[model samples]
Target: MDSQTMRDLVMYWQGVTLDDEAASRLAALSTSVGKTLNAVAGGSMFDTEPAHYDRALIAMAERSDD
Candidate 1:
């Protein structure tokens, strides 16, 4: 995620603010996590579906029921 998005998440989701140094570290950590997940998911792209796909399906079902 972009640094601004990361900062927004920290403030919006976590309800906290970090200093410049901590924000930069948080950005680096997010980058590292994204890279690792990409590498791991690359091989399994065809073999597996995203975990969120289930949530989407559930939401669709709920909408239909409504």
Candidate 2:
């Protein structure tokens, strides 16, 4: 996700007003997490398969709903 989206998500989950500095820090952390996720996904062969990934996501969502 982009920085704006990440910032919005952080703000929503944090449920507190953030100053510019705090927002910047959260955005940086989001970027780092995104990079790490990309790296891990790149290293995984299973993630390359779209259908399986979609199915896994669906399964997880179903479990959460249950």
Candidate 3:
């Protein structure tokens, strides 16, 4: 998934504005997942499944102690 697309998804799910820093972080995660999973740009590549995305984001948040 592309960075912007990921950021858009995150923001859509949370219904919140992701600041530059946060968007960057989300974008980075998307990039990492894309690389790891061989996903290309756009929405179809990476894991965009709502439940999985939420779980992954929660896991990441927990990992960061946020």
Question: In order, what is each prediction's RMSD in angstroms?
Answer: 9.4, 9.3, 12.2
Instruction: Report the Cα lDDT for residue 62, model 3.
Output: 48
Model 3 lDDT at residue 8: 86
* Candidate 1 residue-wise lDDT, 1-66, digit = tens: 667777788999899987777778889998899899998777657766657987878777855546
Regarding TM-score, does 1 or 3 come out ahead?
A: 1
Considering only N, C-alpha and C atoms within 3 Å, which residue pairs clash in candidate 3?
none
TM-score for predicted model 2 compared with the true structure: 0.44
Q: How would you encode candidate 2's per-residue C-alpha lDDT over 19-64 as one tens digit per residue?
A: 6677777788878998999987776576454567777886777455
- Candidate 3 stretches with Cα past 4 Å from truth are 1-6, 39-66
Instruction: Identify the leading candidate in terms of lDDT.
Output: 1
Instruction: Name the runs in model 1 displaced over 4 angstroms.
Output: 1-4, 43-66
Ranking by TM-score: 1, 2, 3
lDDT by residue for model 3 over 1-66, one digit each (tens)?
A: 555676788778978777677787888887788687664554463554446777678677744544
Q: What are the Cα lDDT values of the candidates?
A: 0.80, 0.72, 0.70
TM-score of each: 0.54, 0.44, 0.40
Instruction: Give me candidate 3's TM-score against the actual structure.
Output: 0.40
